[model samples]
Target: MFNIPASNIAHIIQLAVAPVFLLAGIGGILNVVATRLARVVDRVRSLERDLPEADPDQLEVGMRELAILDRRMGVCHWSIALSTVAALLICLVVMILFITDLVALNFAIPVSLLFIAAMVSLTLGLSLFLFEVTIATRFVRVDEQYIMRRRLL
Candidate 1:
């Protein structure tokens, strides 16, 4: 039911092109985040499966690692969710642009707000991703934890 004016169609498409690029970038981020999320999940699951049979001497260390992985999973999950929301908002912005032209409706404010919100979501998501990566790297070695514990004491 798009009765978009022929004269306005080109302009609308041109305006929407920018958001289309945003959507593409968000999709790329989501893909990379999802892949990393999958790997984290697999490792967490493997650790859990092996925990019961873990050497008694190493059980505590294994459990501690598992806890860190769980936190990472939560962070990763929200990062993915936020990225998805940002992508959806970008999609809505593109749709609003076309709808604005088709119905001669004022959508500038809505479009701007949606675009801004999408950007904020992406920013927050990426920040959390960075935090998760930092945490992931921090505990990579057994000796690192002892050093961190000493610093905290």
Candidate 2:
């Protein structure tokens, strides 16, 4: 109802601020994960398009790289999913903050649990991002020219 005190409302707003900031951070993470996923898809499409014209050795190397890219694409997908879940959980935390203030019910346990789950989900998503990057760097083939130049140094 409309009987809630202004000071209580202000306090609720104060409680909500942290979760809102957490939501913004999650949004940024989602953007990066989505961009990586798109890039991986683009690379996969490009490789598929050129596969028919590739010579045998080129085809073999391309196929191998394509497999690695495919794994990267999957990892990016899972990371995005988990990051999205975290963002959604943070949103729930914010809403629950307001609801608890308005209805005068204790939601502290639920809010704490939600925030913890959000952090766990975000951590797992970031770990997957790190794993994806590791896989990508592992398969990166330095140009022979670059290696020869380094050797000359």
Candidate 3:
């Protein structure tokens, strides 16, 4: 029931603006990953500095484990970053298509349906990414458990 003209260029402008939202979302995810990695690196450095020098072999083993943990976290961080970028790109494409359809039909029933679908897809993707980040933070708890066990022995 929208009265916007089929030939209106406002839809094109809206489509162009939609990518900014996608970029912002991607940037947010990257920022979270970067912050998390920095904290992990800082914790590892602290462990290295604080560890006692009494047992060289034990220290070496601890350092090796820390290195492995760092590598694994780095891989995960990169993987999340890449997926965020990819999802953002996909959302941008979908937004463009939704806007194109809206313009062609002047916001008719089919265009409204497409718009709803696009919004739902974007929301679901964002939610899943958030869940992944939450789960990833549990890795810190695992590291803490290892530290506790080491202290016990």
Look at candidate 2 and tell me the lDDT of residue 149. Answer: 100
Candidate 3 or 1, higher lDDT: 1
Clashes of 2: 0
Once fitted onto the true fold, the runs of candidate 3 whose alpha carbons sit more than 4 angstroms away are: 1-9, 51-61, 80-153
Q: Higher-TM-score candidate among 2 and 3?
A: 2
> Once superposed on the true structure, which residue ranges of model 1 sit more than 4 Å away at CA?
1-5, 142-153
Which candidate order results from sorting by TM-score in descending order? 2, 1, 3
- Estimate every model's Cα lDDT from 0 to 1: 0.88, 0.92, 0.60
Writing each residue's lDDT as its tens digit, candidate 2 over 1-153 gives 698889999998999898888888888888888998899899999999999999999999999989999999999999999999999999999999999889989999999999999999999999999999899888896999999999999
Q: lDDT per residue, candidate 3, 30-140, as tens digits? A: 666666667667777777776676388878777765876577565556546564655555565656566656555454455446445545655554565465466556544
Model 3 Cα RMSD, Å? 8.0
RMSD of each: 5.3, 1.4, 8.0
**Candidate 1: tens digits of C-alpha lDDT, residues 37-142:** 8998999888888889989867897889889988988999999999999999999999988887788889789989999999999999999889889988988856
- TM-score of predicted model 2? 0.94
